[model samples]
Target: MNTILVTGGTGYVGSWIVKGLLDKAYTVRLTVRDKDNTAKFENLRQIALTTKGKLEIWEADLLEEGSFDDAALGCDAILHVASPFTLRFKDAQRDLLDPAIKGTRNVLYAASKSGTVKKVILTSSVAAIHGDTKDMTEQGLTEFNEEQFNQSSSLTHQPYSFSKVEAEKEAWRIAQAQDEWKLVVINPSFVMGPSLSSLSNSESLNFMKDILSGKYAMGAPAIMFGFVDVRDVAKAHILALENENSQGRHLLAERTIDVLEYAQLIEKAFPQKFKLPKKHAAKFLLLMVGWMFKLSSQFIKRNVGYPLRLNASKSREALGLDYIPLEQTVKDMVTQMLDDKLI
Candidate 1:
């Protein structure tokens, strides 16, 4: 009976969120840039056919004003998950910052005007919490939580992190200025697992592909991250939408592990298909590779050999979330990648 507006319904995470909502019998009004792309909405259609919920598609663009107005109307909630994510950017401002910040503003503005909208579930990244691994120690942050924000990132340091921080900050600012809608943000770390659609554009999928394809054959960087399953992340979004107690930021990571450990898990799970990197590359070599690949140089200097610690007890207790293990996530992701021939 309740209809929710889901932006980026065709995306990696958005697809799963749409499926979860439909499975719960929620009428989903999905916003996509192109309404004519039947293939993009095919998965949702199939899911809707089997579920009790109904699905509607709308044309909306983040950069264009009033584009989401129709979709937001008469909706019970808005799930704003549409944002550009890229590790390699030709122009940071145009590619990442503008769309992320402006898109949040557009969606919130639409929600503010919609009298039926009561809450907004935003998909923010862990990058919004800490800019660099060094900041974790420099700022005396033993572990990252919902309270800490990324202050060290700028357009120069880590543009993607900076974009997430600024966008989330803007969401808080907009929510403060109005009482029409409550805001709930989910800050997920590196999200992995089987994607509902076969798309492999997400950075996590790319990383998994590289690992399976032997791109990291020589060795892997010592970088560590708190990982969560894509399904759990979507479940968190839906739980936050339904639970009145859910408020503020929720760090949705299940566990933390190093890159090599992740690869070893994949190898152990599927020894015949996955050949993981046995050697660990030197920090300096990773730095050189970062330079050659034109990646964020800060990725090497700050995070390549560092351990990232995140405290997710609050999310578990508040959201009643049972996160799937990182090993299972990696195994599922690797299996999917192999089936799709992405490796």
Candidate 2:
């Protein structure tokens, strides 16, 4: 069986990827920032106990150079899924950029040192595809696909997206410089589904809680997202590693819809349990009260009423995936959050 290393194995999206790998009977070496924080991985350990796969947790910090060498040694493949993702940050460079760019460099450099690694699968985001939703029309594209790289995001604004683009570009540069290990990138849209742990730091969980907790009681902006399930993202990563032909980048969005549509799906499933947004707030209204939700005025003007689309033929044909429906994804997400008392 292949022994693989999964960075950020305790994260919302990362945990699902770990579970997928274990289901296939692969020996997984997982990295966590704090080995002392065993509470975060209790659910995962429980799953491993019931499965044929073995689990090993190692400590690795993203900022410290060479911190991942111990975990990267002797793995057949490395799934780089650890990156800071947050809109709530005072220092962009401290919180996002340094960790993303420097961390990618450190991890791959460690892989280069590790004599046995054959492939590296990076978990990038559609954020690397474009910064704002309005960029589709501005960039003269009918759909944002693998060919597009976000050029509009900056440190002061859309910093998370900027970090992803820089990290992905750095991965490509590193991969080209070496013939020993190849790189493949999975650029997923908004990933939503059940997380293994309830106390996750994922912005996705926060977004869902805000929706169900009436933060958008009046309404929400008309921004659209190309949505995909968390499990599918993991599946795509494994497929990329297994398929020698799976080179370059693959966009992993199953469908596209606005926040209002997502709200409707949750409402349809959990009818009377929580507050759900019923209408789209006007752009002017969003811009006026943007600070309340941490979204800037420029973001509102550019993306509040724009459309988003992603070409999925590459993922469909190359990964051979049957994606989970957006509606079902939302429903399952809400149910799990409720059961976990996360929302």
Candidate 3:
């Protein structure tokens, strides 16, 4: 029950999960697309060098079926955290849906075949709970929770969110078909904070860079969203693994804030370095300039200025999360990006 395999071990969320497991002295096997890509996982290797936990890397591909069999062998559990989270894609179905759904099937099938896996912790998202911030009111709910499922997003809009919800559905379908392993899901909001690895694949880190580098200096669109620290997301996974009583899905978010507030936090943290936006741009202006930011008027009207609410009571009571302050999260992320010369 001590051996655990983590998919996308080099990713932002997965890397932190690996670090937490290592800190707890658990044997962690990481599956990557390529074992020779040392640059992506060098931080993990250094962690193994300093910790008592044993770390191993194996090759696996999300799109390739049966790719995770070698890594899943002899493992007690799995953390499936690998999935694309990009806005720039030629085809949403090809780039997001196929991999997310097919990838979940691949990993879960691998675990089912392993016959040793006791639990499968799926890294789902708050996106799966609610696609748009303004969705709560229409559904007669004040805040989002584990019971909700995203129904607004599709291939044409918020494709990433659609992928997450669909993937979770597919995982649940696979889990219900067998009794060999139990499934638990961790639905984290927009994850931010320092990365365990110095890799540039994370969209969160990239968003911070854009914020500081004046990408939104001309007044950002007021797209309200929920956010959580990356470390907290990792900790939630650890709690789920240790607490055998824990089951089903849990929502993880420190708080809800808007794009303007986020920029202000960054501005306060780094006084003269970043030219953070002074105000949220007018919705009409955003609509006119939507193409520049790859947004549409409909999206701007739906999300801009709308607040998002998340009820993380389940995670608080079940996973014992005290949560991290957004200010500290912003500061830590900025400092890390500076130290790594990423900005």
What are the clashing pairs of model 1? none
What candidate 3 gets wrong by more than 4 Å, as runs, is: none
Ranking by TM-score: 2, 3, 1
- Runs of candidate 1 exceeding 4 Å displacement: none
What's model 3's overall lDDT?
Answer: 0.89
> Could you give candidate 3's per-residue lDDT for residues 1-343 as a string of tens digits?
6999999778888889999999889999998887898888888989988898989988999999999987898999998988888777899999999999999999999999998999999999999999977788678887889999998899887899999999999999999999999999999999999987676668898788778889888898888878999999999999998889989999998888888898988878778778889988998888899888888677777788776789999999988888999999999988888888898
Per-structure clash totals for the candidates: 0, 0, 0
Angstrom error of the Cα, residue 214, model 2: value is 1.5
How far does residue 247 in candidate 1 sit from its true spot (Å)?
0.4
Kindly list the per-residue Cα lDDT of model 1 for residues 1-343, writing each as its tens digit: 2999999878888999999999999999999888787888898899999998889988999988878888899999999999987887888999999999999999999998888899999999999998888788788778899999998889877899999999999999999999998999999998899977785488878878778777787887788888899999999999899999899999988888888888888878887676678978888887778665455567678877766799999788999999888778877877787677677
lDDT value, residue 171 of candidate 3? 98
TM-score of each: 0.97, 0.98, 0.97
Model 2 lDDT per residue over 1-343, tens place: 2999999888888898889888889999999888898998888999998889999999999999999998888888899999998888889999999999998998898889998898999999999989999899898889988999998899987999999999999999998999889899999999888778878878888889899998887997799998899989988998898898888899998899999988888888889778878899988888889998888988888898877888988999988978999888888888898898786
The whole-model C-alpha lDDT of candidate 1 against the native structure comes to 0.87
User: Where does candidate 2 stray beyond 4 Å?
Assistant: none
TM-score for model 3? 0.97
Clashing pairs in 2: none
